[model samples]
Target: MAGREIVLAEKIDLHLCWEGKQLYLKPIPTFLLHHDFFTHAICTAAAPPGSTTASSDLYASACGFLKSYTKLIRHESDLAIAQEKNLIPASVTWNQWCDFSADIVLNTTGMILSQRYDYGELRLTRLNLLYEMHACEPFHWGDHRYKFLLDTISHEWLLFTFVYFTVVLTAMQAVLATQYGAGSVGIQRAAFGCGVFVLVVAGGSCVLMGVFVWLRAYVLFFSETWIGRQQYRIYYLDRILEALVLSE
Candidate 1:
């Protein structure tokens, strides 16, 4: 059977060998990836069958560590936020942290598995790794608040236009009210009352629009952050599965 076919097979446990050691190979933990269970099945299928190899023990241990890691960083919790803020090492960029974690997991797993397997340097290729990394990236907003606002405003042109018109209308009404108060218009009392009413309505609309924009930006940012966290987890899991499948 082809590699992908083997991965999708039903009798996966029949193929996994835990190094003849009595180590308990745990079931795959829940991950943030889209097809997480399928990925786990692939890992199980790719493991060499009926071998008392040391590589099996290493693979099992690595899998255990990964499960624990996922639990510790569950969803977009405080720990995840803190890690995003400060857990980055000097050797990697902030955005590259997930990719770096993948490298660590895959390299470590591959190095252990290669002890008995005849991979012959047929490890997971850089091109495939880069593709997976790029594919799992979260949607990025610009760094600065002003840039984020500008980008959001550009995308929300309709709402922005409405806000802009209201502000312009308010300014015009204020100008008329001032002119009438200065006795420049013949019907001063009537013009002043009309201008004041228009000013109040226009000003109120501007304020409401401003609030809407603020709320929209805040919600979008929060949602993106949550999605980004999940994507990072998926990227990590993908790398582990890729290493196992490609090495096999």
Candidate 2:
């Protein structure tokens, strides 16, 4: 809580690195470090080595805060402001700050001030942050051209195919009309019935295609959410282990 204590906490050599989209926290290995009496007391109060009994819920809540916090931080200036407000540490860059803050808080207080903040306020904050991040990034049309082309074809292909078939059917009807000379009533009736059957088949095919697309999208969404939850659980366990090692 005091400035001296905060400074001491910062003195611990901790670093964050990214491997793909996953973050890893590196600390001085346990065998190479010497701990003082005060450090031992702090670590004991935080959590026991190899156990997260007291810190489990706190760590989970802190992780949610860290993720939302990380998403909001997009620039050096934003990071500076967060540091000024003591929301994050001054020692790290924006990219490295979230894990550091989470590590420090979970090891010390196991509490976040934002936990008391309103949900609506947090949602609005995240929305504003997202807009700012999007606005700051440069958009390149060339990078998205392939995606645009694919989407266009996906949305219009059914209509285009239907139009092609309709044109062919119309040409066939015109030929029948000319050949029959408008006097063969039975042939005309048979031709009309065949055309109706073709229309029915085409409409059924379109309906089936629509249902298939909807199901595919639903499955993809469900799979992504399940995978994301699993990844987050792994990340949380890793962070807890890293904190335990550092405390040692």
Whose TM-score is greatest here?
2
For all candidates in order, the CA lDDT equals 0.44, 0.47
Candidate 1, superposed: residue stretches over 4 Å from native? 1-140, 150-189, 235-248
* lDDT for each residue of candidate 2 in 67-142, tens digit (9 for 90 to 100): 4454446567867855664545456665556554455445444333233222412222233234334642112222
Every model: Cα RMSD to truth: 20.6, 19.0
Model 1: ten consecutive residues of lowest lDDT? 1-10
Worst 10 residues of 2 by lDDT: 1-10
Compute each candidate's TM-score over C-alphas. Answer: 0.26, 0.33
Model 1, 1-248: lDDT tens digits are 11221111122122222211211122323341224553464355345544544445535544434433333333345234434433212333334445534544564443334331221111222322233247432232213443434332344765675677568556656666684545566555555565677677668867876896677566656766878898999999999999999999
The backbone clash count of each candidate, in order, is 0, 0
Misplaced by over 4 Å in model 2 are 1-164, 172-181, 244-248
Residue pairs in clash, model 1 = none
Error of 2 at 234 (Å): 1.1
Query: Quick one: RMSD of model 2?
Result: 19.0
